[model samples]
Target: MKTKNIIFIYILLLSFSFAQSALKIATVSYIKGSCYIENSIQDKSITPLAGNSIMNNDIIHSKEDSFCDIIFDDDATKIHIDENTRVKILSDNYSRVFEVYYGSVFVSNAKTHIKTYIQTLNNNIYVNNNNIWVNSYRDFDKVVSINYNANIYNYISNSQIILKPLTAYNIFSNGSVKIDNNLDLVPDYIEDESYLQVRKENRNKYDVYLNDYDLIPVYGRETEKRSFDDNGFKLGLTAGTRYMNNNEYLTFGLFPQYKHNNFIVYSKLNVYYDYFLKCSSFDDCEFTESGIYSNWESKNDILEKFHLRYHRSDYNNSFSIYAGEIPQVTFGHGYLVNKFSNYYEYPLRSDFGVNIDWKIDNDFLNFKFLVPSIREYFRDGGIFGMHASLFLSHRFPLTLGLGFVMDFNQFSQSPRVYDVDSSIDSRQIKAFELDFELDIIRSMNLDVSIYGELVGIWYPENIFYFRSDGLMPFSDDLRWRRGTWGVMAPGVSLLIDNKHEINFAFNFNSAAFYPSYFNTNYLYNRSLYYLTAQPFDFNTLGFNLVGNQIGMLNDFAINSTNMEFFVPKELYPILTNKINVFPLRGFSIDYKYNFRNKIEYYNAISVYTQNVGQEKIKSQTYYTFDAKLSIKENILRNLSSLNFYVSNVFFLERDDREEYTFGFNMMFDLPSDVYILFDIGQVFYDVSLNGKRNNVLNSGLQLRLNF
Candidate 1:
């Protein structure tokens, strides 16, 4: 009787515990410092604990019982997490993970880890409101040790472990040790030593992955060549598919060039598919705003999945460019601006036609051939637009002129639309553009861009005369005429920058396109209508500079780190709370040129934060300079072990910028096809681009396979 009673109570308790554990699916849990949704009413309610969720910018607490699955539809990404890990759930959107202070999450590779230490730097680093530090600064090729208070242990082959004070260890790697020194190998530990940067074999022009490897190449450079040193040129082709944020597309292109020392000839072709017209398919797709802009395949992002490309060539990256018509800037671009809600840019362009690119920036004069339209000439199907023509003009960071246009255009003359008005002048519209600009402040970089265009049109029948701009329309019968010409208009732009910043420019066009209404059979409160025919132009906001005219919310850059910001391991976890603004991470400032001081500057304040309390938000930020310098030492000469890279961040939304990022990274390379990769991203993901947040992760790896 007693045994039966005991068994009954035991079974009841066990069932209760299991039920409680299942409740976690409904509750929230965290991985590394990233957020994850435990369970939603719509889900099956059973998942792994380390997976990412679908919500961002929301908070959730840990419930020891929660479990979630992280299933990225596209497997182009990997994830990592750290130990003793504790971070609040900011957001866990499957594709867009974002958070503040979700320290120590490294993402890359193809797989994701949970609750693991950062493994990139391969050393432990600590951060807080005060300083930075590192652990056992040694080389893995040799032996290194952690002198526990009195006792000592040895590790062989090195099992790069993220150890903290009072951690116990058995045997695992080349050697073993019993940690007892209250030592905590942190990510911020730093050691200074000189190393050699031996020069390797010279990589020739054919050595790059530009397509054909067996061919020699040559290109004529004007002043400054691109990131190339060899003179020979090779054919470069690329076909890639980008799937990030919320858009997807496939693109393929070709670049053929001949180069010498002071001159060059090059032409190019590129085309792509945007797949479908969804709101989320374009760049800068957002939640607010309305019109066809809203309905046109609205999703998380907006993109022109499909575009064309062509170009000539130029040596100076500053001026003198030849790729496609639409100015060097208008070629192959979806637009030049971000969506009304989020800020982003379309990365490529299709220069309307082909043209010649010339330059005079670097002492010598240079020239290159911009390919003309071969598509229309080939009768490959039926390509009627601009004739395959080349552009020709002078050069200067601010100088500009006009170029002839004979390119192919299909989107227009929408054969998709028929007006029976098939006259030579009315049958075709050749594209042409005249451009000009002024450079006001070259230092802080203050400049304005202006350009105009004229197209083919017909009026007095097929009798040919210069149609206003002398543009002759291609008649179906070979001969051409005048009269049928499109409207003429102009636009303008400006730009600025720093190191980390690739570029920053604003453009506006007055009536680039017409108020295009995507009126279709799908009737509703609003049709996917484009207020302006032009792409992303400032004119939407009244700037009127057609084309892609975008306004940068903020443009700053953080290039390289001083490479010195870590504490020694002997101190263990004592100073784990210190943080630095310019250590492993980079930093840049925003500034305007000051004449008297002859300098550009930004706010001198940098804030650092640390998690002093048990809560994630317990961390606080304060501004300060480093109180200590890394001492140069040669402790471990031949042994390498753990590495850590860290960062942390806080966002003051009102400021429209991130307060700062404070964190670390660590990585390890082991024998065989294995590597340990780890990193902690502090405040890496702040604003939700396209309504999505970029969250930081603490990722660790067991091995890295080089294959």
Candidate 2:
């Protein structure tokens, strides 16, 4: 019995020794998109783990499922996991190390803090784990981080290992073992000096990253960039009150857009009523709505929330070149055409137009036209062009600062003419202009332009018995119309620069509309000349304080005309043109001073005439004031204001008695990104007579929520 007991005691000690583990243990199960297999079991390196496996510092296991043939992408490069392999992410989200048990895998060594366990022996390699870890010995002259608490391990290197140059032996074992804080018997270090301090202060700085590549949903800036891989879309709204006939009414608007690549399909609709809590554009926007995703990316729209009240288009589907219908009216970067808010009166001001822009060789060609076939059906069709125009614009390097614009307009098709002078059958106007862009000095650009025009008339009423190509013969039954009559006008202008130029204009009037060189703002007779300004990026403050004001001035001086009424002529030129100085281009500077109502002095130059016809012998000027300014535009807006004015006039007869304006009024705007709009408008009197003034006000308001 004593002998048996002794045998059992010895067996017990042997069992205890065999059971002791070198590290902690755990297990994991397989999920989707992976497979596992068990193959070899030699030196514990070839053993396969399946269904729920775990380890710590010693024995290792595969990821998730026991079987392991996995694929991962990142610092180690695209790695292919062999059948039945075991590896470990030894470091937690707070650690910077990974551990590989044993297996054959392809690894592409990369230079990044985001690293992998399969160390690089060369630029590239595929290994079976025989022995391939760089010689990370002692790191004598290096300042490396050793986060024992975080990594659960440390580095150890002796003089012998350091001297080995490029070699490492089995680490941490019994018998000939000598340990001094060395992990995997390997020395780890970093090239940075303050690494240790950084690791100590920040715990999760090294958190292992897992993204969509891992089969789970993730969100971030990078994720956002990927979401809109194709074209983007925005379902927004546009609502605002339009002042007409001196009355105020409520307005509601909606705008939705779908964009793919550069192709766009957008539509807008607006409804109106009257008087609420101060009226503006869009009574209710889906800004704060729930469920929908509102991103800074949505605002990524190159253009901002515009007053889109109708369907408008500018691009055309065409080959490199095509002889399109209505070959005239070429375009160069202008969006939208209704310059004034009072479009109800100018019903035919819209146009069903198409534009083509293509560049080949060293020349860039662009052309556009309005289709006469589509008429009143298109709420946005302009009738002015029913007459005619043939425009051709070209850019050349043949001569320095030398370019030309040729345009031809004729009353080729007279379907209907409500107003006509029986003197001519059909009239045609043609002009050709040349410009030399010269840089006299840095930043001082000068475009010297010279052009001549030819106006030919066809007579439908004449005294002859037969009609000549230039004349229509008169019969007792049919009155004769004149044919083929003509005139020529030439002009020149000096532009300091292409961008917001300091301009000077000198034109000799001859025909109604001759060439574009004489167009005060390049705002009309687009038949030639093109002016384009880059839009401001959200991040670009744009000349700091001149953004909103820039748009307003351009709207009037270059693209849209302004109105100034109520201030008398004695104070007109001084209060207006003096302040506006010469709005040859869309640019303005303002100055203000006032001391109570008794001594009120207001001066403003709002570009009022888009065009003054050469034939309009009766020249005139009437005072008018109506504008909207807001801070929501990102800068330069304060004390929302709405004021009315009545003034004298100096016209064809230099009469001071023929002008007046009474309109609706209200004002307001918000901080950044929020809209606050105001309107003060009305048309009191006209017709080369006396002056008058009328004023009215209406407003409304509604909070918005984004979608």
What local distance difference test score does each model get?
0.26, 0.27
Runs off by more than 4 Å, candidate 2: 1-231, 238-242, 274-364, 371-373, 377-500, 511-673, 679-706
lDDT per residue for candidate 2 within 348-445, as digits (tens), equals: 12122232323322222322222222222222212232111222322222212111222222221112111111221222222222222222222112
| Models, CA RMSD each | 33.1, 27.2
Report the C-alpha lDDT of model 1 over 1-707, residue by residue, as the tens digit. Answer: 99999999999997765454333211222343333333332333333344334332222332333212122233322222333222222222222332213223322222111111111122321111111111221222111111111111223433233232112232223343333222233221111110000001112332322111111121221111123233466565545443322334444455566666434555443344445444666685544412221112322112222222333222122233332232321211111100110001122211123334444432233333443223333322222211121222212333333333222322222111111121111122233433333333222123333433333322222321111112233122122333223222233333332111121222222111110010110001010101112323333323222121121100000111211111111111111212111111112121232211112222222233332333223333333111111111111211123222221112213221122233333444344424444333333221232222244332222223432
Q: Which candidate is the best by TM-score?
A: 2
- Runs in model 1 deviating more than 4 A are 1-375, 380-398, 408-426, 444-707
Question: What are the TM-scores, per candidate, against the unseen true structure?
Answer: 0.22, 0.31
Q: Which has the greatest lDDT?
A: 2
lDDT of 1 at 429: 25
Instruction: Supply the global lDDT for candidate 2.
Output: 0.27
Scored against the true structure, residue 241 in model 1 reaches a CA lDDT of 48
